[model samples]
Target chain A: MKLDLQTELCRRLNITYPVIQAGMAGGPTTAEMVAGVSNAGGLGKLGAAYMVPDAIRDTVRAIRRLTDRPFGVNLFTVDMTDDLSRVREVQRMLDPLREELGIAHGKEDLRTPNWFAEQFQVLLEEEVPVISTAFGVLPDDAMREAKAAGRTVMTMVTTVEEAKLAEEKGADVLVAQGSDAGGHRGTFDITKHPYGANIGTFSLVPQIVDNVRVPVVAAGGVMDGRGLVAALALGAQGVQLGTRFLTSAESGAHPAYKKALLESTEEDTVITKAFSGRPARGIRNAFIDHVENSGVAPLPFPSQNTATGDIRKEAAAQNDPRYLSLWAGQATRLLTDGDRAEEIVKEIIAQAQELLK
Target chain B: MKLDLQTELCRRLNITYPVIQAGMAGGPTTAEMVAGVSNAGGLGKLGAAYMVPDAIRDTVRAIRRLTDRPFGVNLFTVDMTDDLSRVREVQRMLDPLREELGIAHGKEDLRTPNWFAEQFQVLLEEEVPVISTAFGVLPDDAMREAKAAGRTVMTMVTTVEEAKLAEEKGADVLVAQGSDAGGHRGTFDITKHPYGANIGTFSLVPQIVDNVRVPVVAAGGVMDGRGLVAALALGAQGVQLGTRFLTSAESGAHPAYKKALLESTEEDTVITKAFSGRPARGIRNAFIDHVENSGVAPLPFPSQNTATGDIRKEAAAQNDPRYLSLWAGQATRLLTDGDRAEEIVKEIIAQAQELLK
Candidate 1:
């Protein structure tokens, strides 16, 4: 009995395989990876987080040029905490380190580009098939708009409480971000709440399945076929893989970044905020090393991000490998040398089918 | 309706809950924390991972002086990969960084003292009631000797395969070290293994209970009475907590280490090898930050560890927070100001009773 990964995934996503090329921030989350996955009977997701409205529009257009297949867009829906005291405190503390890194350190205009609503409007205009958000639940109005526009809305949540919250806010699917997940957590309270468990897909998937009515998408550290079968057996409607795709030929990550991903093992990846003040899993490197060792404090999200952006960019440009952000998950070691999205899709589907039998 | 944590623990250990304060690796696994938890009718454990045979003897004796009650000692077993080539490669790779950290290079002895066998000899001589090994199962001779001497033997395993292996090796009890666990995983094949799952108390306890005939003790990211009750509800005979007790006043983690624990939120902790080459969860800090970014290849187990031992010791001695190995778990943020182990234990029991009803 071969598992119809595509059919099962489509059944769950209301699209094709319970496979999704996860949305990644920065460049690796390319139209090729997304469209390739989608074309191969899986969902490909474009990360629209931190993108300007124009960049998002152009990216959507670019994906459309490549494939007529369905794809999703992801954004950070953080409820901006009005308090700037902590942000200020963090900035004041990290100023010297920024100077040491030879990056200009002054008050970054700490303004969130009200790009989420604008991006949503653009996404609706483009008529993308799916939309997802991390950090918090999307507003009921936004959820209503997306659904009204005939798009499915998925939200990221780590805990059962957040799952319920997303559902209440009208999430069509729940992306359960485990602690082992790479990138920013879709957690609502990054500071106050602790990520609950080193919950493996086996344990967390079933519990979330038991708790929620919506289709559950198991994200975080899922790299290959065994993991995919395990997720489905544990009752996940689909498996969303981020780190695995980052090193694929279709990805647009810097050559150095992709190389680091190839080099990483299960032990090599770690969850750290030395890059962005927000917690994210990535390959251990020089930037992370310097920040973790420096007695200086880290600036809050965006500020700390903006402060170090130059150094990170320089490191990547120089192929320094050390300072570059190597965002990845625990399953990084499993990412082997591979081609673009379609081959990966076929490989995973075939192996997953084998495992189910 | 009250869940008897002690009774459940006793059933799992086939001993008394008043019997175990889980063995902690660093100084935080102190006589006070051990004696107090043991005194309160739960088993207290002395972390003997970093200790030499003589140190283990002295610490066991110290705990004996503090409490006439029965307690357990814990050790790491079988991390020495018999693959000499791989071991040599790892040591050779570590040479540069060792020199950078101002440590002697090319000691090349590569043999970490196999304290497990020696410690077993001391335990037999001293006649401790219970003994356990984390990471992997003890050798046949050690298990046989301990059991033959009327001592109870336990082994920690992170996966079912490992549990079965332990059972095959004649382990009397199994401690299920879930992925949420704070310390080094007792996984035998750290190189090729997938950390099974979030496998928290809820998911792990039941599965381990069903699969193995021996009693199961759940460990990892567990805190408070709610967690204890939940574990018991999932069929855990008992629960072992490291992070929760580490924050108690009875703990000997450096003041800075304790402070980091006290100040931690779920976001504050991440699994990293900035301390030991092995992945362990701890309060996020500069040591982790520096190493994470430096791209300096971390020395593998025992070697990577030996290289950093001086810096860690020096940092701890000088109370320089930057270099301290602040090993802790996600539960660090939940720890309140109270330091009394007895009070914490009583409160956990009391809270569990309240929730159980």
Candidate 2:
């Protein structure tokens, strides 16, 4: 059997394969992992959402030092809202957990850092090759600046409406993130509930591809070569995988978190707003269940996310995945133990080639 | 353009194309449409969930008269429960709409018809080549009888657990219906909330395929050849489509319903339990919004389904889809007007051929 796997995405990105290592926030996507994937002939993206300007520049420089291959940086465009009462309620709910974990209660005057602008400025200054935006649309000026700096702009969207808007606002690529995707949904409105637009990647990619002329990249629940080929068949030019790489040797995820993912089944993951106000897919644990059953509405994004930072940190330090956000897609079951980022890229491409043949 | 589109599903079902015209309940899938698709080299399925034993036998014979190609019959295996008070509540809520539509309020002793057993018997007696069970697993006895009669059994599942259970119960194939799939979800426990398992076809198919050795058939949000090829790449042996064929000339959908689907976009559909207690995807209309916003809980399956029957009838009689349940998948935007079932099968194959090449 002869199969044509080279897509427009590969041509535009100048990559050997249509697979992209997802830029997972809060650490799994490390500079080493990004460079490893890119060096192995697939595009890799640095998860720069939680990084400060200096950190972003350092990480980009580190990736450059590792490999001169084309890579991308992902940032979050979040709307900051102040709702102290809700934040306080969440803090109250987490009081017991904090006590149990021996962590200090988050301060009442807790503030979320707005680092997106600084990160964007760093990307331009560093002349990043590609940029991917999640949580919401990239600001027009930022998008323009990136283009001016010879960067490719890709906007992540959970719905076709957002895909159209991103295209209209000059997106070179659309990352159609499905509900099964790990991490926060790329729904444009941070204030709107994320679960309302629950279109899966299989359904989302084709519709987005049909509605937009730009190349579409399928994300969420994609774990292997079959997934990459499947996305291409759905009219997508490429696929972005996150969970499969969470356990990669170069990934920054805690060993316990990686172990939990490896031992888990597809049904183990749930979409919850516990770790963050926005819905995200993660392995279900005590913390998620507690927050859901607590009857306390979570504070809006960034606030709730910030409030839980201490808990997650302590959980990671203790090597306990229960209180930590084990962000992984529904396809976590497909992940294999001991696969390096470079090996993962090569294995996926090789398997896809054999299947296509 | 040459494409080897023959999949395991096609070989197992002995069909020329790896496509199955979805057995959409509440009309749209007519005997003529089923036969047309079968004659056109794709497996066509009769939506026999609402038919009595005699009607089922007659429809099977009617299809046999139209085409000798292999086809399938779909039935709902729902566990019915009686809750008169809840039924009355739905009736009371719809009283105003009933009067507005010049429809009579449902009778006090309104009871759901129990015809599944009789329908199964008809299927066995009629020697239906393929049997597809929705809503629940096919009983062991039924599965045995179907297999004894040389009938292939396909179970529809919304989750991987259900898929595993169905496979253990002797399912020859699995139809992995994603959340974006139109019509009632095939969740086994009718009492369990349907929307809780929000897996999309893209996400659901591969996971289910990974869990079960049986060939998986991808359903929901698939509208054309690209979708068919995509499902295959996801490890699905074939694809089942619903909304795409809603406007086929041979489809039983009302002209207004067909028009609504054709004019609609992907965002026009909503998964709501307003029409039936079980959540189903359909084009948003006045009825859905009214029932959803009315703050009244719908009665359980079969009861609420029966209570709203009159309003839907009246609405269809008036050619008003606002009141009628215009069931369609999220891929309604891909539907075109006036294509015949044969043309649809041919077009899908042709388009897929070009793309695969």
State which candidate has the highest TM-score: 2
In candidate 1, position B322 carries an lDDT of 68
Judged by DockQ cut-offs, is candidate 2 incorrect, acceptable, medium or high?
Answer: acceptable
Show where candidate 2 strays beyond 4 Å: A1-3, A190-196, B1-3, B190-193
Model 2, B1-357: lDDT tens per residue?
212588777889999998898888777788899999999999999998887779889889999999999999999988766566876667788888888888777676788888888999998888899999898788878888888888899899988889999999999999998877887878887444455366767778888988899999999878888888778878888889888888999989999888888887766778888887888888889999889989998887778887888888889899988898988787776788888999999999987787676
Give every collision pair in model 2.
none
Best by DockQ: 2
Evaluate every candidate with DockQ and list the scores: 0.04, 0.47
**DockQ (model 1, Cα):** 0.04
* Number of backbone clashes in candidate 1: 38
Question: TM-score of each candidate?
Answer: 0.58, 0.95
Residue-wise lDDT of candidate 1 within A231-281, one digit each (tens)? 554456778888778778888889888888887644566667777667777
lDDT digits (tens) for residues B1-357 of candidate 1: 223455534754444442245687767788778888878767888888778778878888888998877788887875644223344554455445445455565444555555566777887887778888877777777778888898878888765667788888888888877676676767776575433233333334454665788877777755666456545544557778887887688787788777777765544566776666777766667777777776664666655676566677766766677667777655553566656887777777776656444
Interface RMSD, in order shown? 12.1, 3.3
